[model samples]
Target chain A: MRLYLAYFKIKFLNEIQYKVAALAGIATQFAWGFMYIMLFTTFINNSDTNAISSSQIVTYIWLQQAFYMLFAFWSVDKDIFDSISSGNLAYELTKPVNLYDIWFIKTLALKVGKTVLRALPIFLICMLPFLGEFTMTAPVSIMAAVWFVITMFFSTILILSYIMIIYILTITAISPLGVKITFSLMGDFFSGGLIPIPLMPDIVQTILKYTPFYYIQNIPYNIYNGYISGNLEIIKIVGIQVFWIVILIALGKLLMKNSMKKVVIQGG
Target chain B: MIELKNITKTYRVRKRSAGMKNAFKTFFKKDYEVIKALDDISFEINEGEMVGYIGPNGAGKSTTIKIMAGILTPDSGQANISGLIPWKQRTKYVKDIGVVFGNRSGLWWDVPVDDSFELLKNIYKIPDDVYKQQKTKLVKLLDIGEIIKIPTRQLSLGQRMRCEIASAFLHKPKIVFLDEPTIGLDAVSKIAVREFIKKINKEDKTTIILTTHDTQDIEALTNRIILIGKGKILLDGKLSDLKKKFSKKYLTVEFNGDIDQLCDGLIFIEKYKGRIIIELNENILTLAKAIAFLTSKIEILDLEVDNTSVDDIVVKLYQEYGI
Candidate 1:
């Protein structure tokens, strides 16, 4: 556990060095947020009656933009891929720590660090006096706020587990780019990043509810908007999130163990 | 404390020819060639022995090192290091060993060297007192006190290599495997690294297994040399013994007058106006007999006898094995 914390600290410090990249990411996400708001507003205006109000939809889009880094599946970590390709894997494998946990902690630190760096600035910019109207509303109740945090915690675990599977694939000599693109597109499409789950057709929403992607961003977003109310519903949603986290983690561990058996550290 | 018996490792490398057509064909149907990386290699090193593992390119030097370091498992072999199988007891076995690859940077590129050391301290679970004591000793020995505060990327190759060696020692591992540690280092840096390696081997009684192409490193550091070629252990014995076995005696004499004549065992290598160089084979003729024969033929003014160096003996071994 202490070793993992060391990995976290080093990776967090490493990610903080890329402040310029984080600033650029915030600008790009803000632009996308505006585009999403306009699209959502037009959809709500054309519909005779909507499940979610226009103000709530606008706030959802803003929140999605702020949490983009946390929910999104980025590329396979190039540092790890390069380490394997450049033969640094030899040194990495010889460490006393478990290889899976080493990468898991590093990946978690990178994601959380970048999210904090970019999301805080985006959140502040949205909360400015002039932009207050576009900002998300506070959670409907204290329960909603508490469930939001709980669901987001589980959501992060699910996403990290998903990324770990891709990393394991990379070590097994399969290119992660193809899997990354497919998974990213599917995750964005179903996780309410491109379109909110409530606005989607009922059939599509039903299908997404069965997929783990729905629990990642959509659940947290819905909780923040007070769409998922009552203690019973929040507990059920948190239960499903925990289930997916465990399943994904088990799959990652199995793949890692099998792949490492035939591990080949190429080059000198 | 380390033993390997009949270790063998084979790598299946994909074979592809150049040209777009061949590339496309290989994408569909690939051909693989099995390369014997380590072929029945066996050796034993007692604790605190500094053994130089030397070989030519593709001679399985890195493969053997990897197997010993627990980075790769041999296909068929029994390897026991510190009474634990490296690959089977990887987590526990690795804690007692440190490895340094010359071409790779084990330290974090963007952080200060000391930060990486701290991380390693945590990774190895070293107590604060032990960590500080080891770090201080390594810093002074490697002369890297100032550079430890700088990021690894900003340091020169020599400085980085020094820091890398120091990082490997921070955990105070019982066994250290160095693969080409002095590669690409300047003469001074090379000597410094050699001296430091000697110091640790002497002071800590740490077993050091070094693989290098530089014969000077072998000459300066290790008394025993294990030469591998073509995935097989070609030679393993005292460095002095190997040198003496392959060493040829060279006799250079400045003669006042010389007659054009040659002996059965002596091969005339070069001849000038008054100077002549001849190689003596000890099996055919003794040095005393050669001198008697040579003096009778010509009036010798000055004579010098020299034996082959370790470098020459290694080159001769490589050529003889056709590796």
Candidate 2:
């Protein structure tokens, strides 16, 4: 546990060293948020359905943008690929810790640290006078806030499991770049980062609800918006998230175990 | 103690021709060739012994080191170190071993060396007191106190290599595998690294296996050497014995009078002014007999006898083995 924490600390410090990249990311996410809010507001104005209000879409866009570092499918852990190609993986393998757990902690630290660094700035930017309407509202109730936190926690684990699958695929597949780009694009389009799931067509929403990508961003945003208010409904949502987390974790572990047996450190 | 029996490792490397057509064809259906990186190689090293592992390019030196360090699993073999099989008990066995690859940087490039050390301290689970003691000792021994606070990317190759070696010893590992430790180092830096390695081996009783292309490093560091070629152990013995086996003695004499012809066993190499150089085979011609014959033939003004250097002997060995 201590060793894992040490990895986390090192990775956190490493990520924060690129302050320019963090600032630039905040700027880009704010621009995207503004465009999204305009598009969603125009769409809401033409619709009569009350399934999701214009204000709710605005808040969802704002929240997703503020937490883009967490929601996006960026390569949160480039070190894994770097180590493999640079032949440092051999040295890392000899360390007295599980390779999977160490990388997991590092990736977690990278996401959490970068998210913390950018989320507040983006949120503050969204709260400015011109963009005040896009600012996220506080949780409707304490119970909603509690469920929001729980869902966000599970969302983190689910995303980690997803990333683990990519890491393993990099070892087994001939080229993981195509796979990574495809997954990233799919994750954004289907995970409610581009458009809120509730506003999508019923068929699309239904299909997404059954996929793990929906839980990554959509569920947490909905819980924060108080869309899932009843105790039974909240429990059901949390249970689904947990189920996906377990399944993804199990698949990730099995893939990692099989792929590691054929690991070839590319260069000396 | 370390023991290896019939350790073998093979790599499957993709093959393709140069033309675009061939490249396109390979893209669809690749060809693979099997490369035997290690083939039935076996050796033993007792505790507190330092051995030099020398070979030319692609001679399985790094492969052997990786297998012994628990980073690689052999295709078939038994490798037991400190009563634990390296590949079988990887995590536990690696606790007592350290590995240094010259072409790789084990330290984080963006952080201070001290931060990397602290991280390793936790990774190895060293006691706080022990960690401090070992850190101080290694830092002082390597004379890297001033540079430890600087980021690794800011240091020169020599400074970074020093930190690398020091970091590997921070946990007080019982065994260390140094693959090309002095590679690309200046003469002074090389001497400093060699001295540090010797100091640790003598003071801490740490066993070391060093692989290098530089024969000077072998001469300055280890008494025993294992030479490998074509994924097999071609020679393993004391360094002195290898030199004795391949070295030829040479006698150079300056005399007032010398004949144009030489004896049957003596081959004249050069004659300049009044000096004559002759190659002598110890097996065919005794040193005493050669000296007597030369002295009887001419009035000797000056004489010198010399044996081949370790470097020459190694080159000869490599050629004889056709590696």
Candidate 3:
């Protein structure tokens, strides 16, 4: 809708104003990327099971860092959270608009806006060949690159849908802190932000596949690193990503509708 | 046209005492107290009418506004605004109404005020020509043409409030609910806001319901006022009628001779050499009779007559109602 586009533009423009925050975020991502690489190398070097190759690990870590914000499960729009908690939602309700749709677009714009500022620098820096073993490699094939792009787009929406569910959950709770913390911790570990899925034990990866988190960062980054390949297999994974996106969004909308009926703005 | 019948709202709030021990104990048991925010209350407003909604703090003024604005639903009520139920058909009903809360902002804090207006235009689906006309009129009336170019956070409170008023009217809704629109404003800004409100309500035939503790706002803007206290509608009548009911006249006279006793309706407040301040109850003693008595008693050199202000009337009303 045109209204949602306008909201997106306003939210995106608002987000890009924090230039210092973007710079600080880039530095933190680099530090985290290097630390993750260092820890992963020791585990891969000591093992001989060949669960994941060294080159795949390096590329996966770099890609995750480049698009860190896009896939981050803990990154919720604080404005939306505050609106729910502080009774400012009364103003939002006065508008002739659906609360869920506006918030979805706002979260999407915030993630895309922040990722735009930080992703490019990390991508350009990590592509440099002089970094030796730490350098990030390109996609294994042109088809893999295409699949990576497609999956990344779905994954972003997928995660945003999941975040909306958390938002609805927060609305039902007395405080947002508990929901945010519980989801942040659970999503971080399950979405493979804590560790690459291929590097984890086989049974854990099998268990994660049953949940939507397995399809989030795990599928896209692995596809880029050539860990999950072949046309049929990649197509199957993309299909599953679409499936989860539909499911999470439906679940979120249902919850939002139910919660809205009982929603009470406590004080003016 | 707006109407409410038997509207009631009750809020369940968790009860807890102070200190860690009581807090811990209540956390487990979780006792809740139901507060009747709005009792069985009803009122109606005709088109193009400006009504002042006055009450003490926590008197359900905001709750009634929220219910009518579609931000809240009452526990039991039937409210029809423009032939639409506010809570049942919120998305459709809200299209005809606007709301402004004085202490809170509806604008995007980091963006230019124009951007927020643009978004509102899109959200309300206002036609291009209509939006432009509304914007130009509001900007000129509120004197926010230059202020709209700046980001909202950069503007002063007065400037931001002007823009806020402008944004709410950009769509030209049929009704506008203003909760303390003149609060914390300087004299000039307050007058400008009041003038703009009056102009809009008159020109567009837009119904306006204003709630404020500022008696001057009520006195200057609205003729009809609905007074609520303790979740009940205590008084609903014309402002002039309430003024007549609680009216008192203060007469200060500087005279040559004033050594005299007061009448039954006349109470002497202050007496100095050749000067006297008397409280005249207009209900019992007319202003003309009080003046006649005073002139007869002394050769009045100078006289000053003052009426009881709206503030005093409100305090008296509250005390009378024991709220």
Candidate 4:
């Protein structure tokens, strides 16, 4: 755990060296956050369906956009996979440590830095305009925000396991682009990044329920928007994430062992 | 300790004719061919033996090293290194071996060599005292004290290869695998690397398995040679044995007094006004008889016999095997 924290610190420092890029990320996050807020407001203004009430819709959209990186699993998880597949994995392997823990720490650090530099600032920027229409007195709502962050962290690991499976074979076939493309479209819609699941028709929801994407985004959206208000639902979501974390970590370890069996790096 | 039995490895690669149509055709139904990289290879090295693994290009030298290093599992064979099966107990097995691949770096590109070494130390959890003592020794021996602090990107190829060898030895593993330790090095750098490797192997008894195209590397460092050709162990013997078999013969002669007539089989190869030298095939005429025949006819010059060098032996081996 201490090593992981140190690795996180090192990764953050390395990332901060590119100050302009970091600032640009924060700026981009804010622009996209504000755009989503405006789009949700227009949807409520122009439609009678009232699929989502204006204030609730705006709040959920802000949080969703703020935490876009947390929803990133399939597309973002390949960073580690790519490193491991290219004989570059030796750099990590020669270390007298576990591959999972080291990568796990660095990955969380990247996402956390993104969350801090981009998401936190974007949330702050909306405060000036959102203060007038929203109620800030709900401290229980703050608990939901905390749970959503935890969900995103665990969700990232679950998604990484799937990506690692593709990477293991990437070492064999000599490419990961195909697997990356597979994750992009299906992962985006399934994870509720394209559209909120409950807003989807009944049949789509039934189909998506079987996929892990719902746990990544839709459930978090429910918590953020008061659709899931009870403490019990928060516990269930956290429990699901913990469950996946255990299973996925184990699966990743197994694949790592099997993958090493075939990686011939001597002359290559 | 390392042992390999009947190891075979094949790689399936996609192949296609050059054209957009072929590319499109490959996408739908790829033409794949299995290349037999290693075919029924076997060998064994006792502990503390610094053996050189040599072969012509694409003779499966790297494949053998990779399998022994636990990077690949053979298609059909049993391999045991230090009483551990490599592919099965990978994590534990790898902890005891240090590997350096020439032409590729294991160091982080943007970081200083020390930073990379520090990370490796932490990763291996080496005792600070042990790490410090060994590092100091290697630094002094390789004369890389000033180089280690520089970023890897800034170091020259020779400087970096020294650091690379040191990095691999930090853990003081039972065996060190060097794919091509002296590749692309200047003559001085080559000698320094060879001396450093020789000192370590002599002092610490560190078993080393090295593969290199540099014959001088084999000559200067290791005496035992395992020659592989066409994916099989063709020759396994000492440097002297190999020399006696295929090495060239050289005999130098200096005139005791001025001479004119040269005997047959002894061609006048070099002449420096009043000094005479001759070249002859040792197989066709023995040196003593040639000298005796010359001395009987005329006053003879000083003469010395020298066996062919390992470099010439390697060239002849390559030609004879036709690899």
**Native contacts matched by each model:** 0.76, 0.65, 0.71, 0.33
Candidate 4's C-alpha runs over 4 A off are: A1-12, A49-51, A74-86, A90-103, A129-142, A225-227, A250-259, A262-267, B20-31, B251-307
DockQ of 2: 0.68
- The per-residue C-alpha lDDT of model 3 at residue B30 equals 86
Model 1 docking category: medium
| Steric clash pairs (candidate 1) | none
Question: lDDT tens string, model 2, B1-323?
Answer: 89999999999999988898998997679899999999999999999999999888999999999889887778999988999998878889999988899889999889999999999999999999999999999988889999999999999999999999998898999999999999899999899999999999999999999999889999999999999999999999999888778878899998897578777679988888798899998888899999898888889988999989878978998998999
**Residue-by-residue lDDT tens digits, candidate 2, A1-268:** 8898899999899888888888998888888888998898888888788888777777788888878888788746777777765668887887888887887898899898888888998777666667567766777788888888888899988888888777777776665677678777887788877778888899998888889987888887887786657889878878988999899888988987776677766444
Where is model 2 more than 4 Å wrong at Cα? A128-132, B251-266, B273-276, B282-306
For each candidate, the alpha-carbon lDDT, in order, equals 0.88, 0.86, 0.91, 0.73
Candidate 1 TM-score over all chains jointly: 0.94
The collision pairs in model 4 are: A96-B123, A96-B124, B254-B301, B256-B301
Number of clashing pairs, model 3?
0
TM-score of chain B of 1: 0.92
- How many times do residue backbones clash in model 1? 0
Please state the error at residue B164 of candidate 1 in Å: 1.0
lDDT of each residue in A1-268, candidate 1, tens digit only? 7888989999899888998998898999999988888888887889876688877786678778887877777633568877765778888887898988898898888888888888887777776767655676777788888888888889888888888887787776646567667777877777777788888988988998888888888887788787767889889888998898899999999998888778887666
Name the best candidate (by TM-score).
Answer: 3
lDDT of 2 at B61: 92
lDDT of 3 at A131: 89
lDDT (Cα, 0-100) at B181 in candidate 3: 88
CAPRI quality level assigned to candidate 4 from its DockQ score: acceptable
